[model samples]
Target: MRGTVAHLVPVADPDEVATIIAASKRAVGAAVESLHFPLVPGVAAAIAETDNAWRALEAEHGLLDAAAVSRMLGSRGRPGALANDRRSAGKLIGVRRRHQYLYPGFQFDAARGRTRPAIPALIAAADDAGLPHDELALWLCEPSGQLGGDRPVDRLDDADAVVTALSAHVGVQW
Candidate 1:
């Protein structure tokens, strides 16, 4: 990395300097992400199991890509309207899987093509609890003791129950 910087960046223009810094930071981040760390056999197996479980869950139900979500949302005049709305009010449950983020299909009412009413409060609670979105996605897919062994995704319509469960979680992984 020390030897990687062979070109001098323009320092006279603050904007140009900032752009260079931002690009370099992104490159560093990409480098870090691309690195392969040593993994114990046991840990590797556990990770594989977890990933398989998640894949099974995703396959059993369904995952909606952003385009699918936007399509279901119907073409509004504004691009990324669903994201904008969810950002402000937490109306959706989205999670990253692999290279792209996918939304849980159960989050929406299939008939109406709209987000389930109960999703907002639950998403908001999950956000408040600071649970990583990916964990939330996994949590929703798995059965919960709090819901009497029912998966949160299955009980998505029960806002009170889900929110209560989320509050009880207090940001801890489910």
Candidate 2:
């Protein structure tokens, strides 16, 4: 409802109008199936929440596409393979956008040619706490009073501090 809709001429010819209507019908059906049909109950809400989460992340912390992440990692591997490897290592996580992966730039230090050491541990903490990726991303970008009003990513240099924050988040020591 918030997105742009194209304007079209309403044809006077019955055959042309019917053809256009048929095409519109098919397009609407496909859009509905792609947007909602595959989602289970409650997933639609999560998706909507994550849309805001992603927007917040983009505003505060720039995101990198799969290719950029791969280049930062110093890997010549294909983007998908690199993503899988990072996921397996618990060192990197990305959100999917229209079949493409977008990695958070904060997770890696391009100068180091590797993901920040705290990333994997923090990712594990988030997983153990059952926090979804979008929530984690948002939390990481938000300034915290406990952190002296610094974002969690800003304190990445101090792994203990980041882990402490995550531990407090899940109400457990990690």
Candidate 3:
């Protein structure tokens, strides 16, 4: 096994985020082009739908909880080399939940296992989409919580922007 582990940090500037996203998009476009998937008529439409869905989630709920993000990115594994291959390709793992005030009257229910990390999912999504893996990985790991030097919402907004930019980069439709 490669046994390589790395962390991605969040970005601070919207313009920087956009540039990173654009680069990732170009990468994905090249990968898709190489695949010669025949450019089905609905591919663009599907990508648009996925993009809208991702944007709506960002607009309404902010960066998705780790578990939700993992699910959105289809980070599940089928075991053995397949899983290892995915991981080697920059898939995320080790997601867990952090406490938040959004859910009122909801205590930390320990019965439910810890949430899975979203980094692996983000990585997997990037890999699958043929996006810029290193950039996306960095975005997921870097600590941007203190960047804005303002409210918590600012941090959330930053994260959301990263997610949005990533989705747009991947040309996700729905």
- lDDT of all predictions, in order shown? 0.71, 0.73, 0.42
TM-scores of the models, in the given order? 0.68, 0.64, 0.25
CA lDDT, candidate 1, residue 111:
74
Task: State the lDDT of candidate 2 residue by residue for 2-102, as single tens digits.
Answer: 23122232356767767776786686567668784364677644664566567667766677887777777777878557866786676786766657667
What digit string (tens of lDDT, one per residue) describes model 1 on residues 1-174?
234322244256767767886887786568556769743447644664577667766777688777767778774655556654563556777776777667777787867878888787877777777777667777877788888989888887888998787787664555
Name the top TM-score candidate.
1
* Selected candidate, larger TM-score, 1 vs 2: 1
Model 2 TM-score is 0.64
Q: Say which candidate scores most in lDDT.
A: 2
Where does the lowest 10-residue lDDT sum fall in candidate 2? Answer: 1-10
- Off by more than 4 A, model 3: 1-25, 66-174
* Rank list by lDDT: 2, 1, 3
Sorted on TM-score, highest at the top, how do the candidates line up?
1, 2, 3
Put down candidate 3 lDDT per residue, 66-115, tens digits, no spaces. Answer: 43433333556432333334334544321112442111001111235222
